[model samples]
Target: MTKKVVYLHGFASSSQSEKAVLTSAFFARYYPHIDYAALDLPYAPDAALALIRQHIGQTTEVALIGSSLGGFLATCIAEQLGCRACLINPAVAPHKVLHQHLGRYYHPVLQQHYEVTAEHMSVLEQLMPMTLKQPQNYLLLLQSGDEVLDYRLALDYYQGASIKLSEGGDHSYVGFAAELETIANFCQLA
Candidate 1:
């Protein structure tokens, strides 16, 4: 059967992100049969979820690759769809983490502006899986040098899952290209 991998970019990020571009290129070059989609998600949490679901349509057995906020969204989607997901430097409890940064936010890459509100946090909280029902379906990737978020949070949160903790990398996940094969294997793209 054919496979599909939907990539979700992090908060304030676009499909043009380095990781997203690399992911698309890797799949295109090596796994030509696999459908790879990196969508530009809306800043609004609810709208983003809606767009992801709409893109997924009725397709079953889809795989997900989510970075940062995308990782958080991937977890929610995977739980609901019972699919495998590769989370890279995923945000843990973003509802709590983003509380301090609540206000108007802008992304220069997308030339978009959006509000960061308590309601968005509430939506995130509701989407969060109190406990992952199928932990084996997830692959958590973390780096120690993430300045934006503490990597330990993901380590503690994603316990009981397959995790690869690297020594040093920023929030953007340095050397991410090297892991493309591993991610593809985990998602059964091969």
Candidate 2:
């Protein structure tokens, strides 16, 4: 079956991110039949969820690919929509981490500035899935040497899910291109 894949970038990142671009390019080169959506999501949690849900509702066979903060959001979406997800060093408790950067920040690639406020954080708290209902519905790809988020957090949180733990790599998830085919295969039905 032709599968649909949604690629969600990190907090400060966008659809134009290196990972997003490579994901898109990979499907374009190999799996041309797939449907893909990678947007420059708004910082607000509600807005981000709305955008994700809209695209996902359009397809029955859907999978989510999220990185960092995007990984956090994907988990929420996956539970609600009953779709499978692949998290790239996803954040288990972004509220705790985001609180550290609750102010104006800039996205160099998008060339836009935004703020992370307490109100914005409240939305994040509301959306966080207290428990993953279907642990089998996920594929967690983590790098131990990540400086931004502890890989152990994801390893613990997604305990029952399929996890690929690498030795030493940064939060950006080096060598992501080599795994696109597997990601595509996971998103489809047998």
Q: All candidates' lDDT scores?
A: 0.90, 0.85
Writing each residue's lDDT as its tens digit, candidate 2 over 1-190 gives 5377889999988888889999999878877777778877778788888988877776657888999999999999889777899999999888888888788988776687877899888888888888899999899889998999999989888879999999999999999988787777777733
Residue 79 in candidate 1, Cα distance off native in Å: 0.6
Pairs of residues at least 3 apart in sequence or in different chains that clash in candidate 1: none
lDDT of 1: 0.90
**Residue 189 in model 1: shift from native, Å?**
1.4
Candidate 1, residues 49-137: lDDT per residue as tens digits? 89999999898868999999999999989989989999999998989888777899877776878898889889888878888888898
Which residues of candidate 1, in runs, are more than 4 Å off? 108-110
lDDT, candidate 1, residue 13?
87
Runs off by more than 4 Å, candidate 2: 107-112
Error of 1 at 71 (Å): 0.2
